[model samples]
Target: MNNQQFQTPIEYLKGVGLSRADVLKKELQIYNFEDLLKHFPYKYIDRTRFYKVREIQPDMPYVQVLARLTQKEIIGEKRTKRLIAQAHDDTGTIELVWFQGIKWVEKMLVPGKVYVLFGKPGFFNNKAQMAHPEMELYIPGAQQKGNLTLQPAYNSTEKLKQFTLDSKGLQKLIAGLLEQTAKDIHENLPDYIRNRYKLAGRQESYRNIHFPNDANQLNEARYRLKFEELFFLQLKLLRNKLLRTQKFKGNIFESVGDYFNEFYHHKLPFALTNSQKRVLKEIRLDTQRGVQMNRLLQGDVGSGKTVVALMSMLIAIDNGFQTCIMAPTEILANQHYQTIKSLVGEGFIEVALLTGSVPNKARKVIHQKLEDGTLNILIGTHALIEDKVQYKNLGLVVIDEQHRFGVEQRAKLWRKNIIPPHILVMTATPIPRTLAMTMYGDLDISVIDELPAGRKPIQTVHFYEAQRLRMFGFMKDEIAKGRQIYVVYPLIKESEKLDLKNLMDGTEIMSREFPLPKYRISIVHGKLKPAEKEFEMQRFVKGETQIMVATTVIEVGVNIPNASVMIVENAERFGLSQLHQLRGRVGRGAEQSFCILMSNEKLSHDGRIRLNTMVKTNNGFEIAEIDMQLRGPGNIEGTQQSGVLDLKVADLTTDQEILQQARNLVIEIFEKDPQLAAPENQILNLAFQAKNAGLSWDKIS
Candidate 1:
């Protein structure tokens, strides 16, 4: 029952020689017995029923038919050639066709022989047919030889089938493997967890997962395996969090002092939402605890996340420790600089901006102030992490859109000070709880789920190309009310040429409709220079231009309260999160803003669902959950880069409860055994260490 037995190479397994092993390794990544064991079935089939030919229906799913093979012949020629065999039962006849491996199939066919035929039933040319059906010689009382509750079906490629490594072949190999190793499956979970959750034993789970005795047993096996997968993942993340707090020291912001007090009382733009207040309190507690604070702040666009970040930075400054905020782009970084400057008012606290485009002379002065004690706050893009940009006791770093920056880039910021700075990463894209538990599990999380008072929700509507004129009229009405408009396109220059063309064409139509002098319109896209894009953005912001046509380049950080209408052309081409962000561009001001989604009359099902979801709700978290369901966890932004979303059985979209249970169990275990030194937990500790052997970033948020 040694664990090393599972590590044996897959080539050494019974029934698999060198050639079949090569195919399995190449096609399925099954290099060892462990990999093969974890390769669970996608589905299962019931093989107890034998259908009569008369009972066969075209709409039926996979069916088994025990009938006599009366005749066989090849139909058509060359590419169209197929081996068709006539299968007859007591009532009627059906056709079994095979277009692939025709010669091999013909060699196996025998006239007047009874066989079990299994495949999907289809009605083509007024006759029942089963294409590429699996055939086996019928034998009476064969069911007595072995147990047949449910048959496992594995995914296989046509390349594997050529070597007879299809689902049936794989099932046979798994059965043999289980016979030898099922009893040797070592238990990793403690007795307490098993008894509390009523989970199946590791050995029983593995055996039933591949070959179950009944439906209840199959369910138990699936639940146990899924729980085990997610349990280990949560254990790694929680242990990382525990180790980080113990190892990394952060500069303590013991005092709130004049800056934070002044901003909260006198200079505040608006009253804080309950959720925002809660998040600030959480940050306060973390910073006061004197431990490195690696917290993720989630809020919807215009939910006032920047305000929260600025307030936290003010606390650091009050404690006589400088702080900085890094953004993903120059525009966003500049935007944060301007917003914080205005919020701080003139001469309150010394703040400077550094970016790639900053003049050398100006950068020198800023660097001097940063090195001295004069600069209280510095904000920039990736430029903040440059070697020359040293801080005089940098205590905190607030990174906007943190995913855009690489881990190494963020790590460099930590190295700026002797004590690693507190990290507060802000993201406007709302992350579902299950995803946050797995992806950002190492970091503490806070969410500003509510928006500020008096801000109206944006009204979203979908329109077809035929209704373009009506949309234009609506835009004109909004412009008449002294509000600006944003028309965003999903344009990619290198790949989506048609989309680029669409942007240009749409701009031309806008120019013709609302010509320059009275109705000023500015055009912008990714291809434009930074200065050019900024100039266009400034024009729209200044109200000099009533309309701005651009790409998704403006999806983030270009905030104008006066811009009340967002017109997204070809809306179906965008994802749910992108569409939500685009809609957020409006509804910033007091006016009842609108988001117009324009697309072709013909729309895909997913496209329709995305549009409908946007129109139905304004809650970013709700939209995020639905988006994860539609696109899966890996495809969502910021998650694919985590490398932790590679799940085998537990789905983030559906197994939220299971994930919560696994996380809770990890928390409980850590509370009782912080070092996992308990005798029953030795296997768990070893497995956890093996799982995270070379990952150095576990200590870094």
Candidate 2:
């Protein structure tokens, strides 16, 4: 259809008035004709098949039968009232009942009249019946003439149903729309793409998607639509990357100076793994290229990403530029500050920490040093992005746990320098390949898959509640060995619905079991104030407390090398990624480390799979892949807000092949027509613009 016609509001449609249009928009977000057209069916039923009354089985999904009503009855009083009718065919009779709309159903049911019935069959009192079955008057020799194999089913809500806009009503509106505008639908993909993919015309695809004549046509229609969706998504991401590389000039760090060399040769704590070396090379190459580097660094917990980020910062400093690291939380910011400070020593290079809690007196000094270019490296939480915080020559920005920050916050960091600074985003939560490609497709990705040397792998084990005494004994033994332990509970307080073990009750039990002066336990949770939590955390970090009992608040920043045991209570309540992060709290020392997963006996199928997977492997990527399959991409920890996975048809887990093909095709298209200025490619450019008009990120580098 022409652009104006497709954008026409639904209230102008034949069957939809103002009230119905409002419901459509509120319920399904269908504002215009194009949106209604793109609303594909969730499932379909075979319309050609008709079943005998006797053939109606309780196990049948949905059956259609031609029958006549012989008797009608209304039973029960108000609210619980129901309308029942006996429908009979040549073989036998079955009852049809409606608990809702009883008065209307009684008027619609006519005795001794043939009707078409379709619904799921169930057994009640040893007899087959259908509840709230769809019914229509049947006429002999009046069926539509075509290869009608399937009838589409659309999703509807109770609010829409009240306005008679359920699946059947939506089907009628869509049918009317197609009859008027099917031929007017315009082709969006270029001729070359259509020819390469052997795709059907856009009009035919939309037609078959809603009302398919055969299975082959429906399959082809689905593929064409899925391909188009993925193709455009890739095109947008690749175009953004191209624009950034071409338009933005980055500060070049030409050489590695004395700071890098000194840290590498004399002051380094451990030998760098090959994977770490490889990632450093990648970052080094990007910084020297003179193109603004937007890169994502993915690694498992305790994978030494902080060291690589520090080394990259050193390169920026070598080139006479300032650098900063932005973290999501104050605790994590302090952790990074302490680690970097100890590694760099007191006199080698100047480093400072800025957070919300910094006093005004200290803040003035930091702001002065930053403006004068004396602060070589500054690390802080979101305070780094405040309006007053200015840098002399901010060249490299390393964002820790980048996903926790929003796009606008990162953009603020970019605007701090005259030219956008080189960005290195670090995340310990490993993302699956498909997710990384789609969500952060504009950024180059480098993964550190290997752990550092001399660090032993954490041994993981699962235990049922019946083994509580045994698990407690193991904890006691570990504590007696001068190793600290973390006992993580899922909830801070008791949840009546979840029946999970809370920190309060668990702490009480622990105090009773281990008792008084022999053991000390520190407690922290989300409800605690920052200062209060820090106080408890410090007790554990200093080894004054042998056990730290807390919630998932300890999932990220607290790093105590002496802690050798992680006990997760009610482990089934946590996702795999959270469990993995909690497990990473231990195993930092030279001694052996253990992660004990404690759950009840009756674990759900998904919960069992999650716990079993944790017990099976330590590979973060493997766990992420399984988690994506189980929870899907939308529910993954940091991906829900990306909007890239707001896909209608393409499944990230199953449609990897299609996504890859679309990306490759995007590359080829750009190579041939970089600006999409060619006449044949104008349609593609226009479609892209129409789809992403006001989204600033789509156009910005």
Candidate 3:
């Protein structure tokens, strides 16, 4: 349709009045005619066959029957009143009942007339009955005369249904609008794209999606729509990437100077893995390029991401520029500071930690050092972005657990320097390929697929309640060997009270079993004060405690090389990603580590899949793929925070091939015509501009 016509208000549609339009907007977010057209049906039903009255079974799910209305009456009084009608055919009769809107039904029902009834069948007082059946006057030969064999089913709410704007009502309104606007519907994709992919025309797809002639047409319509949705999303992300690369310039690190070399050669703790080396080369290449680098570094937990980040930072220092690392939590910031400080050794390079807990006296010193360009590296939590904090010639920014920080917060760091620093976002959580492409598509991705040498893969096992004693014995043996253990309970927000009770009860049981001075246990949870939590964590870190019992609050930061065991209680309550992260708490030391998943005997289908998947593999990427399939894309750890996966038709879990194809096509288009200056791409330029008209990340400048 023409642009103005497409943007016409929904209230002006054929069947939608002011009241109905309000309901439509509130119920489904339909504001304009284009939105009404794009609201495709989620389900389709075949209406070719009709069941006989006597053949109706109580267990049947929604059946259609052609029968004659014989008699009707009202039952009960006041609020309990309901309309009951009997419909009979050649075989027998069935009862149709409606609890509400009795007046509307009574006026519509005509005795001794044939009607088509559709609803779920159930037994009431040992007789078959249908409640809230959809009724239509029977018309012979209508099916052969262009009536849709496949009927669409739209989603509706009770509030909408009260206004006669239910699924059927929506269908009628859409059909009326399509009859007038079908021919005016515009083709969004260019001719070459439609021909190469054998995609249906936009008009045909929209028509078939709402009312299909048959199953094949319906499938074709769905495929075209899904591909289109994914293609445009990929196009937007890739275009943003292209524009940013062309527009922004970065401070170049021309040499791998003495700082990097010293740390890489003499002060190295262990040999760098081949994967780490390869990723470092990528970062080296990116920093040397003139364009600003926005890259995502994905590595499984304990995969030596920190070393790579530190080396990259050293490159910045070598180029005479300051660097900073922003972490999501104070605990993680402290961990990074201690690790980097020890690795840097004494008096080689100046490093400082700036977190909220840092006192004003020490903070003043850090600020002064940063401004005077004496501090080579600074690491902190969100406090690094404070207005009081300023840096001289900041060239590289390393964000740890980047998803935990909002886009605006990360943008604040860019304002620190006239030239935005090269960004290196590191995450221990492995993201599925499709997700990474959609959510972080604007950023180049580098994956460290292999673990560092000498670190053993954590052996995982599942234990039932009956086997608790055996598991405890195993824990006792590990503790006796001078290794620490973590006992984590599920602390979901909805069940915090019950989970806390479980934690306290489990702790009491452990005290009773191990008992007295021979065993020591430290407890940490979200409810504890920061001082209390830090004190308990330090006891375990220092080996003063044999066990640390807590909730998933320790999922990210706490790192204890001496801890060799992770026992997750009620593991079935946790998602696959969380379970994997909890499992990563161990396997850091030279000794082999074990993760024991404890759940009850009875397990749900999804819960069984989660636990079994954990037992079968320790590959974080594999676990992440399965997690996406099980929980869908939006629910993954950082996806919601990205705000990019607002998908209506594309399912990332099942549509990987489509997503990849779309990304490849977008790259090809950029290669051929970066600005869409080609005459054949005029339609694409218009469509892209129309779809993306607001201020996005790429538009920040």
Residue-pair clashes per prediction, in order, are 0, 3, 1
- In the range 21-54, model 3's lDDT, one tens digit per residue, is 9999998999999888888787876665788878
Provide TM-scores for the models. Answer: 0.92, 0.93, 0.92
Q: What's model 1's overall lDDT?
A: 0.88
Evaluate residue 287 in candidate 2 and report its C-alpha lDDT on the 0 to 100 scale: 93
> If candidate 1 were superposed on the true structure by all CA atoms, what would the RMSD be?
3.1
Q: Give the TM-score of candidate 1.
A: 0.92
Best by lDDT: 2
Model 3, residue 633: distance off in Å is: 0.5
- Give lDDT tens digits, candidate 1, residues 181-243: 887788888788889899999999999998886788899998998998999989988888898
* TM-score: the better of candidates 2 and 3: 2
lDDT of each: 0.88, 0.90, 0.89
Among all windows of ten consecutive residues in candidate 3, which has the lowest summed lDDT?
492-501
Best by TM-score: 2
- Cα deviation at 132, candidate 3, in Å, is 3.3
Kindly list the per-residue Cα lDDT of model 2 for residues 199-314, writing each as its tens digit.
98988999999998778888899888889988898999989898878888999899999989999999988999998999999999999899999889999999999999999999
Error of 3 at 44 (Å): 2.2
